[model samples]
Target: MSRRLALVIFPDFQLLDVAGPIAVFEIAERYRPGSYDLTVEAVEGGQIPSSSGVCLAARPLSQGPLHTVMVSGGDGTRDVEGLQGIVRWLRTVEVQRPTSVCSGAYLLAEAGLLDGRRATTHWSRTDDFARRYPRVKLDADRIFIRDDDVWTSAGITAGIDLALALVEDDLGAEVARMVAQALVVHQRRPGGQSQFSALIDLGGRTGRFGPLMDWARANLALPLTVEQLADQAAMSPRNFARAFVVETSTTPAKAVERLRLEAARAAVENGFDPIDRIAEAVGFGDPERMRRAFLRAFGLPPQALRRSARS
Candidate 1:
């Protein structure tokens, strides 16, 4: 039986939020015939202009049975008053799986569907999302998250990852893998994987710690204790720790660990080094400790990641 899935959109919605998932489901259907019936929907239907100025033709919001209903996110979500209709519709929709991509989680939250549910959205919107929907457990560090029947993903590209996961859930891993290969993307990134690269903003809000971050990366083999980092930054340990968090939005210890992970992962995936050697070079000191860290942060062990990377 084909599962009916709808991609809900609004005016000024992000284009990829809809397109990425469309591509995933379309590819899956090709691999497993009659696996899915996909539709693009809007509150009033017709042509909806995306944030990038491109427009997509959509059908009127349907009251018919659907297996999954996914809402796309973009600048349109900022207009809270403009989306009341969607909020109301979402509240009454009887889809088996209610899902969202990026800021679309905002609508689900607005409709009260995500209340007390573990969800995720774009990393940049986490602060505002948490403030607006305190009842929703927002995990800022994820590509996507599923709480029972509700699924939410982070950012535009993460939508592809979310759809690939749904394909796997419905059509098995082989079909999903073939779809991913056809799409030229990873077979599937675990929902627990961090969405953003920590290196992108290691310097913090003002780039005040840029030099320190670079130095830490270059010296990942050394123990990057707070005191050692503080000395390098020319500040007392206590004052440095306090200021680091205030500036970076992360503790010094966490920042160091992220830097090490970034370096270690690169070596693990791109080189033929032993896991123990890679772990030691990245300051993890022990192979088992690095494996645990990899599992916690990536939902996969070092060995599994290595094999996936090579495959």
Candidate 2:
């Protein structure tokens, strides 16, 4: 049986958000001819301009059963929440599964589809998304999330990751691999893989503890006690802990652990160093401790991450 795949786009929608997933399903169809019948659509139906100025012609929102419906995200989604017609159409759509790429989760959230659901979006929008939609469980670190029949992915290229996962779920791993290979993607990153490590944003920290976070990231191998960090930030330990949580949205120990985990995972995946050596170098002290940290952050042990990276 052929499944109908509908991609919903709006004015100023992110181009790749629509193109990437379409390419994945299109490629998958080559492997299994007629596997999918694809359509690009919009609420009004016409040529819609993307954020990049490229235009995509789309059909008007049609009434029917769709195997899957995906919504694209961009600056336009901010306005989607206020469009009564579009919002009403989204609320009324009947589909076996609904999905969103990047900030498209905003539209789904606005339509009440993501209430009490686990979803994710562009990492930079995590705070705003959480603030606006407190009903949604937003995991900023994930590459993508699938709760029941709904799927949501992080920003930009992560849409490709989500499509590859869908292809895997429908046609099997072999077909998904072929699609990924044709797309020239390195590998199908697991959904559990983090979008990015928090350490990378330390330089952009705006709080009074900005320099302290930079120092902490650089000195991940050190003990990095709260007192030490407080001294670095020129504040009392109690005040520092309180303020740090308010500014960074995480505890000092957790921040340090994330830094260490990021560093250890890089070494494990990209270098020839043994697990114990990597652990010690990253302040994990022992392989067991690093293994536990890896499990907590990535849902995979160090060895498993290493093997996946190599494979």
The top-ranked prediction according to TM-score is 1
Query: Tens digits of per-residue lDDT for model 1 on 1-311?
Result: 99999999999999999999999999888888898999999999999999999999999888968899999999999986799888899889778999999999999999999999999998778889999999999998788999998999999999999999999989888888999899988558789877655533458766788899989989988999999999999999999999887676568888888888878888998999999999999999999989998887777888998998898
- Which sections of candidate 2 miss by over 4 Å? 196-214, 242-248
* Count of steric clashes across candidates, in order: 0, 0
CA lDDT of each prediction against the hidden true structure: 0.89, 0.85
Task: Write down the worst ten-residue block by lDDT for model 1.
Answer: 193-202
Write model 2 residue lDDT over 1-311, tens digit each, in one string. 79888898888999999999999999999999988999999988899999999999999987868888888988887775555566677788888889999999988888899999999998767899999999999998788999999999999888999999999999999999899999998678778776654523453235566677678878888899999988988889999888876666567887778778878888998999999998888888989988887887777898988897788
Task: Give the lDDT of residue 256 in candidate 1.
Answer: 84
TM-score of 2: 0.85
Error of 1 at 86 (Å): 0.8
Q: Please list the Cα RMSD from the true structure of every candidate, rounded to 1 decimal place.
A: 1.9, 2.8
